[model samples]
Target: MLLAQRLPQAGTRPSWPRRLRAWLPAVPALLFLVVFFVVPVVEILQGGLYNADGVLSTAQFARMTHTPVYAKVMLTTFWIAFLTAALSVVLGYPIAYLLARLTARARERWLLWIMLPFWTSYLVKTYAWMLLLSKTGVLTTIASHLGLIADTSTLAPSMMGVLIGMVHAMLPLAVMTMLPIMQGINTQLVQAAETLGADRATGFFTIFLPLSEPGAAAAGLLVFITSLGFFIVPALLGSPKESMIAQLVISSVLELFDLRFAGALSTVLLLCSILVFYVYDRVVGLSSLSGDAPRPKGGQGGRALPVLLAIGRAAGKLHFHRAGRVPGNRGLKLYTWAAVLLLVLPIAFVVPLAFTRSPFVAFPPDLFSLKWFGAFLSSAVWQAALWRSLAVGFSTAVLALALGFGATLALSRMSGRYSKPLFAMFIAPLIVPRIVIAVGLLYLFARLGLTGSDAGLVIGHTVLAIPYVVVTLSASFKRFDWRLDDAAKMLGASGFTRVRTVLLPLLASSLGAAFLFAFIVSFDDLTIAIFVSGGLNTTLPKQMWDDIQLAVTPTLAAVATSLVFLVAFVVWLSSYFKRHSY
Candidate 1:
């Protein structure tokens, strides 16, 4: 009888208190983005408009476009990224397919194969490439010995070699990002097409291909962005013809010492990368590559051959269950083993090269010595850079971790769809080339007298590493149970105490992994460190970079060997701590 009267109620919108509760978690993140991300970018774009004379001018901008070299270099940068992205897509897809389709145990074992080279230092990884592709390097000597090439000159520095090494560096990341998405796809979709008389080609093109495009495009985006900022790989392994924007940026800074022009150059490089990335997103939506299957068994990559024929074998076994029917099972298994070996070949050259007595790299060494190691450890120039690298690396890690945690913690409790969008905003630095961020920071910092200083390098690196921390921490956050925090609050705890005692304790693995990963990324970085720090704070990677370009010797190899072990140790410790924890 009172139904009509009940219809007069007012709007049920959340009150200010509820809105405040909902928005609280976002405050810290918003503040950080505004301060570090937005401000730096604004200053960078505005850099060319002003000069050291305290007056505005277009001299820097005019200087940038006056010559065709930068323009050519910019074009070169784009194509390299495109080529690198294409190469990674081809090599990474098959490996990712294996990991996604294979047993859980196989997946674990395969990751060791995927990660062994990747977990090694980036510069060390590049040095390993140096050994494999040198004039008398392992690959060249073998090809000549087998009469595959006329001489060792065939494998010497060129664009092709640069692309190959860059692909090697970028492939692991592409596979890791793509595998999970591939795993999430149900294996049955392709089988259904096959049973409907769709042949292998038809099934792949119409069904699986469209489904997996998101991961492919995303991985491609990542490769392209990362490749744009590549300094060490090309600097060490390629010749002058392949000089990229990163090389140009470094020249403007170190060679020319024209801070204004260098900042302008960085601005251009950054803009071009963003333009290409924007086009990629227009072509393929990024959100589609969001998820994938987690660990399967034995490492998923170990069953490339067997995943081709699971059902029949599953029926044959008395205990057959999950993998009852999959094709190419045995062949897939064989292929998986081959895949692992293929991944290892490039980096495996280091073992022999390290022990060689030749001052320069050679195959089937006539001698062995530890002299290089001794030199690497004792050289004042290298030792100073090494110490500097550790200090900057640790600081960069801590800074990134703090910024990431603040943002992630604020974003974690948000209930609105804005959270996803906010997370994407935080992810912008990663997808945009480091060239852009570095340039932006260079321009901004110079005005503040921070350029080429330790503080400047720290700011630049932390900008890059923040995204790494955010990605890892976000995953940990998604898995967290809110009840524990609530439980802590109910028992009488302040927000900081709850975070310290409850949140931090629960996220130890994520924190540790993020820190180590952040350190690795910052340590391995050469592009930003090169321009932003000048020679004042040469990170280990930048030092190796200069050493490689100036000359290659056993001393570089000595440094490479030590870095390999350092990186491997950290990764092992991270995993160990994860396994031992609750």
Candidate 2:
């Protein structure tokens, strides 16, 4: 009774055990980051500054800098990134603006349509594009019939093919980034501008465009940064000229087995990303980008082309006959069906080919059996690898969410001076190429005996995932009300009690959101997983990548389909939970 009274007394010191108890939940996260994440990066930095024996030196970096091949690869990476960034912005901005301007119903429907790409696995999307655009693909057959491709081989794979495929994969990301800010734009402001007699075009360019600039730039930065280290599409669907930094890094580490050179190359890629970000910040003001121009009071888009299309619809209605609607959305139906078929065909190709009576993977596969799938599914090597990949993805997701939550909390708690730099530091991963982080992890983990371990794979993925989690949670956290804490404390709550009962309750939803988002990010993650998981720990995406490179098999196709269904199911579950919970 005396001790309890003293504990509640003013200015009395808290017991050490109680404070330690409060910290227990956060300990696992802290330990994981320190041992796996922090150590790996430090190792990479140290290795880059030293030789194999670990003596400090800059010889490796110097050699890499002088190599003309590095210069060429760097240039190629830049050009491809720039092009992809531009295309993503071009395709994404209009849709984002439309999403912003539309009614809730229209916006939801449009967004779902845009998100259809997410329904397909990234691997499938790329492979499908290959089939759709390949010499023996549907495009080839049609082109040949029309005498467009005199030589079928010309359409197999090329620089342009890689560009098209990457753009498709990247466009959805660009749209997502811009959608939030666009939704916040004030329509009344635009109406007032129109009332002041400004033309729509003039008002849009002067007002709306600048307001949406920040969102656009952020989206563009995301697309550009991700494009810098693109590997799969470039390797499987592109010519040598299209090789990106990711492909180069993979070759250096795996084929050449030279960790030193890989680390140096990765450092260069990261430095280049930092340079781009610095340049972007200087050139484009981030604030004006998030704002939006006012919407007109009257309905928008009264353009001539739209009117002509409307007229055509009316005429077709008036000319209604037995065959009144021959094209009855037939054009759109054809386009949609064609795209869906093309998107799914590659994986579909692998299924039958896997069971092909013929040993060689070929079209018009005579084989129609499940032998390969059975062999792959039954093999201990594959079974172990599959389990390893699943474990790595989940562990990475957990690691990412923990650090992201703490960092975001710390960031939210901070104000003014230290804020910008810390926020920027968290944001740095967005632009820093994966090659840089991968190399860093490889070097760093090797010192700690973490290489070829599940711990290393988790660290690599967690690092890659942190930026997204931070960005997502930070956006939500910034809007959170701190008054709730005050309210809880006024009602007789202590710091711990307030956090648990008040803060955590409010943030629980966001935490869940962040976790699921992080999970998908980790699941789809290939770069860090590939680099870090040397032997014992292999991720699904990495395994899929190996199979693609070594031999494209139908069992791989089935794997791709399974992965697709998994992602889609998770997304659906998330959506359902979001609706019921939020």
For all candidates in order, the CA lDDT equals 0.72, 0.66
Query: Can you tell me which runs of candidate 1 are displaced by over 4 Å?
Result: 1-30, 48-68, 145-149, 188-205, 280-327, 330-336, 358-360, 366-368, 487-494, 534-537, 577-582
**Per-residue lDDT of candidate 1, residues 1-582 (tens digit):** 233233223327546654576566556656766666677766666665679885888878777577787767777877988899898887788778778877876686677667767767667777777777777677778888989778736565888778878887888888887886787787698789768765554454455555666678778888887888887777777888788877776677667866667667666766766777677555554453345332333533223334423432343343322343333456566766776676677666666566778877666654668877788788888887888778888999998888789778867766536665777677777876676677666667767898778887777788778778888787788678877776776677877899899999989878998899888887777767766767645778878877877776777777887887787678776665555444
Q: Whole-model lDDT for model 1 versus the true structure?
A: 0.72
Residue 66 alpha-carbon offset, candidate 2, angstroms: 5.3
Q: Estimate each model's TM-score.
A: 0.82, 0.79
Clashing pairs in 2: 43-444, 190-294, 211-291, 213-289, 214-289, 350-554, 356-367, 357-367
Identify the candidate with maximal lDDT.
1
User: Could you tell me which 10 consecutive residues in candidate 2 have the lowest summed lDDT?
Assistant: 288-297
Model 1, 299: alpha-carbon shift in Å?
A: 34
lDDT of 1 at 405: 90
At residue 202, candidate 1 shows an lDDT of 48
Give the per-residue lDDT digits (tens) of candidate 2, residues 1-582. 344344335445666555455345435545655655556555556656778788888898777668877767778888988999998887667667666766776565555545546545567677666656777767667877888768635465777788778877887788778887777766677568658864444345445565566677778887888888788888888888777777777888889988777776676666677677776565553332223323332553223335444544454345432332322335434544454444344545544555665555556677676666676789776777778877777887777887877677666665535555655655555667776777777766667787778877776778767767777677667677776765665577877797678766777767776777677777777777776777554777777777777876666755765666676566665554444433
